[model samples]
Every structure is written in structure tokens, then in C-alpha cells.
Target: MNALYNCISKYYPITSEAWKALSNALTQIKIPRNSFLVKEGTVCNNLYFLERGCLRGYYSLDGKEITYWFGFEDNFVTSFYSFISRKPAVENIQALEDSTLWSISYEALHLLFDAHHDLERLVRIINEQYYIRLEERFMAMQFKTAKERYEQLIENSPHILHRISLGQTASYLGISQETLSRIRSQV
Candidate 1:
């Protein structure tokens, strides 16, 4: 896929054999809207790279879905804890639209990492980036006011409001649907 090739090319110019090997390890999967890639309590077997459409990672609390992050085209989506430790995932990854993605199994990823040091470095970089995003989100939730968070959310992801429902967006911002509506009224 072009997305996969682009990500690989960002790290290095892969040899023809390397490209072939990488391609061999990946598979294209189409997910219907509201379908799940990783469900709660299941080990996440693959790292998904979104090619088209959108997805969200959320956890249920008090019968509520609280979204922590969204993934769209060109983003890598996965439950790292379940994928890395081979344990049950605490979160769910769901498609918000008809989605296309390229996925590689954890075992296949490690095999490729072992086979190529550069790929290992690339993986490390991606891991660090993901961690930083999580840290930033944690900080934002702790330090920013709900209205401020709402503003930052739009600034960071201007297209998200158009893509998902307000209730979900409210959940992502850790606010109730009514509160989100009030905030929207001001904007």
C-alpha cells in the first residue's frame, strides 16, 4: 500500500527485497462502521495502519464509552499493552466509518525488527511518539479546563467534529453531551 511504503520510506530507502518482505507481512482489511479491531479483554494481535476512514480507542466506565484518542488516515492504531505483552486489552478500537487498513501481526513485526535494525529504530521512534501523545493528553486532561480542552481538541483536530457524533466528542473531551452543547453554543 502507498501508506505503508510512505512510512517505510520516511525511515529508509528499502531494498526491493525488504519492500517485498514488508509487503508480505501486511494484509489489507476492510472494517464496517462500528466494527471493532481490538475488543476489551482480548489480546491485540496486530498493529493497524489506517488507510482510510476513522477509528477511536475507548473504554467503558459506568456504562459509558470514554474515548481517549482518534485515528484517521496515515495514523497507526493499536492497543500497545495487549499487543506488546500478549495480554488482554483494557480498551476497544472501533471503526467509526467504513475503514480500510493495513495490519501486521505482532509476531510478524518482531520478525521484521529482528531482521532489520533500521526497522527496529523506526519502531522505537514510533513508540516514543505514541508515548508522548499519551503524556500530552494526560496533562491536558489534568491541567486544562473543559472549555480549554474543547478548544484544543478542535485546534488539534479540526475535522473531528465533522467526522464523529457530538456525544462521542463530548466523551473524548471528558464532558457530558449537554456540557459539550453549551460549549459549542459559545463557539
Candidate 2:
């Protein structure tokens, strides 16, 4: 949990009391590769901190899985829309590797926010960061060519190719596996 503490400290320092409360709320769980952390049509009840390994968020469309985002170690993982709106999620979150994560239920998190202003502020900042990344991705998809997108992905997150299957990577880029292979060879 040192990793979680370190990450929280980077965002905002909490009182010992708040830390105690948060620690009590966190439950550690391990998910094997290809396991679903969250499935479509379910309400996401917990927010997870990826302590080790990777996860991907995707949606099923026209019988294809379109990956939208990835969560790596030290990142928070959740279906934001479902978690916030109390609605069923349209996206599925799956473990890309054998993973360990610290999870806190929505109720527990809201209780903490009510009790600790610092914790609330920290979460607000984290959400803001998430929104910024989402906007960046939206803009890229709207404006960039597939080649340009692939190049940007290589420049920004080259390690992703090593961590996930090419097919998944291609899906995330909104391209076919064959097209990704062609772009990769040209690059």
C-alpha cells in the first residue's frame, strides 16, 4: 500500500485520521489475465487503484471490441460514468495481465469525501486529469489520420505495444490489425 500512499501524497497530503479511514476502506484483490473487473450493463460499485499489472476499458460495437483506454500501475480504474451517475456501464474493464488492485466502494469513498476535505480535493484533481486525457483522445480521433494517430501512440506510449496484443492495440487505435501491421512496418 506504500505505492497508494505515495500516489495520494503526490496529489494531497491527508491527516493520519483520514489515512486510517482510507486504509480501512481499501480492499486488495487480484484479477487474472482476461478476467473482467467490470462488465457492461453492471453498475460499477468500486473505484480501483491498479497496484500492479494492466487493465483496459472497452466497448462492444457491431460485434467488435473497441478499446478506449488503458490503466496501468499507479492509475485509478473505474467506469466513471456508471460510478458517478449510478447507472449501468456501457464499457467493460478487463485485466490485461495478472493484476493486483486496491478497491474502495462508492459508499466508502463518498463517506471519506464527506469527512475529509483534502481527500475530496485530491479526487477532484484526479478527475480533472482524467477529463483532460479524455479530451485529448477525443481531439486526436477527430482530427488525426490513422498513421498520425499510430505515430503519436508510438511517441507517447510505445511501451503499450510490448504490453498488449497487436490486435488490441489496433482496436484502441480504431484500425484493423492489418493496417496496424502495415503502419508498423513503414515506421
Write model 2 residue lDDT over 105-177, tens digit each, in one string. Answer: 9999999999988888888988998999999999999999999999999999988989999999999898999
Q: Against the true structure, what is every candidate's RMSD?
A: 1.4, 0.9
Q: Where does candidate 2 have its weakest 10-residue lDDT segment?
A: 8-17
Model 2 TM-score? 0.97
Candidate 2 stretches with Cα past 4 Å from truth are none
lDDT of 1 at 44: 97
Would you give me the overall lDDT of model 1? 0.90
For candidate 1, write residues 79-177 as lDDT tens digits: 999998999999999999999999999999889988876677777878888899999999999999999999998898889999989989999999999
| Cα lDDT, model 2, residue 80 | 98
TM-score of each: 0.95, 0.97
